[model samples]
Target: MIDIRDFHVRYGNNHVVRGIDLAVAKGECVGIVGESGCGKSTLLRCLVGLEHGWQGHVAIDGKPVGQRRTHEELARVQMVFQDPFGSLHPRHRIGRALSEPARCMGLPHGRDRIATALEEVGLPAAFADRFPHELSGGQRQRVAIARALIVEPPVVLLDEPTSALDVSVQAEILNLLSDRRDERELTYVLVSHDLSVVAHMCDRVLVMQEGCFVDQLTPEDIGAGRASHPYARHLIAASFPDAA
Candidate 1:
């Protein structure tokens, strides 16, 4: 469902993402893991149309998308950012935020759609009347998920989705995402530094370093500490220090 070729992103003279080529199939979850400044998130930004300066060929759902996208094209792909609070408007009510996308797309049944979206994320419909500040981090993240799903997009890009939440709540959010994917048959591109999260949620893991894909592994490889690439081995070892 997603194809990227020879992708490169530059900030002035410094190149952050270099020659990336990747393909993600429909209904499959792919995880990208790397250290800070490795351009993992930058790649996502380019895919979701947040960053326009990237140079590459990117095709989503078999259609090439330029820097400018139509509402229909934009609605086909959605993103759940790292920080829910930061992504959501501080003043907007949850219902308003949830309805905006559909409203912009001229989709009907806004009220019923908002209720269903909240329920799908394990949130009470009553919460729609509340603000972002009124909800817990987990709740806010669920609302973020709901907002992304309300548009009924085929592709969702998650960037460090559970990193900001408490550890106890992290599993719940991840499980919710997993369940949603199974129920909806959605395609996901998950970006996370946590191997445990990647292993739990992704079918394939791509190891990125210095803005390039150095190795790829399955969840089983992560559990067995079997990686051929030096950086992949280092990452696995670091994540499992007891085994290392």
Candidate 2:
């Protein structure tokens, strides 16, 4: 459902994402694993039209993403950002954040839709009336997920979806995401620095370094410690010290 070819992004003179070519089929969960500054998130932002300096072809659901995307086009792919607290305004209630996407897309914005989104993320419908500050870190992230789902997008790009939460909370969020993907038949391109998280959630994992993917690992390869590239091996070792 998503395709990119020869994609490159630069900030001034510094090249961030260089020559990224990838394709994600419908209902597939693909993971991009790399350390910070390796350009995983930069590549992701480019796909969603957050970065304008990118050069290449990006098509989501057969629609080429340009410098500016209309509300309807953007609703085709939703992004769940790294920071949930910053993503949501301090003053706005959870309901407002969830409904804002529907409002922008001219879709029906009502309590039932918002409440269903909240419940889908394991949050009660009543939490919609509460503010972001009133919730814990996990609760805040759940709200972020709800907001992403409120648009009913086919593809969701997750940037470190569980980085800020505690371990138990992270497991909960990952399980919730897996369940939602099955229930909604959603496609996901998950970006994270954790190989274990990628292994647990993704069907295929792309190992990125220096703004390019050095190797790709499937579940079988990861399980057998068969990463071919040096950087990929190092990442797998770091994620599993005892196994290393």
Assess candidate 1 and give its TM-score to the true structure.
0.98
Candidate 1 Cα lDDT to native? 0.93
Worst 10 residues of 2 by lDDT: 235-244
lDDT agreement with native, every candidate = 0.93, 0.89
Q: Which candidate is the best by TM-score?
A: 1
Please state every model's RMSD to the true fold in angstroms: 1.0, 1.1
Report residue 105 deviation for candidate 2 (angstroms). Answer: 0.6
Residues 146-243, candidate 1: write the lDDT tens digits. Answer: 98888888999999999999999999999999999999899999999999899999999999998999999999999989888999999999998764
* Model 2 root-mean-square deviation: 1.1
* Model 1 ranges off by over 4 Å: none
How far in Å is the alpha carbon of 109 misplaced in model 2? 1.0
RMSD of 1: 1.0
Error of 2 at 177 (Å): 0.4
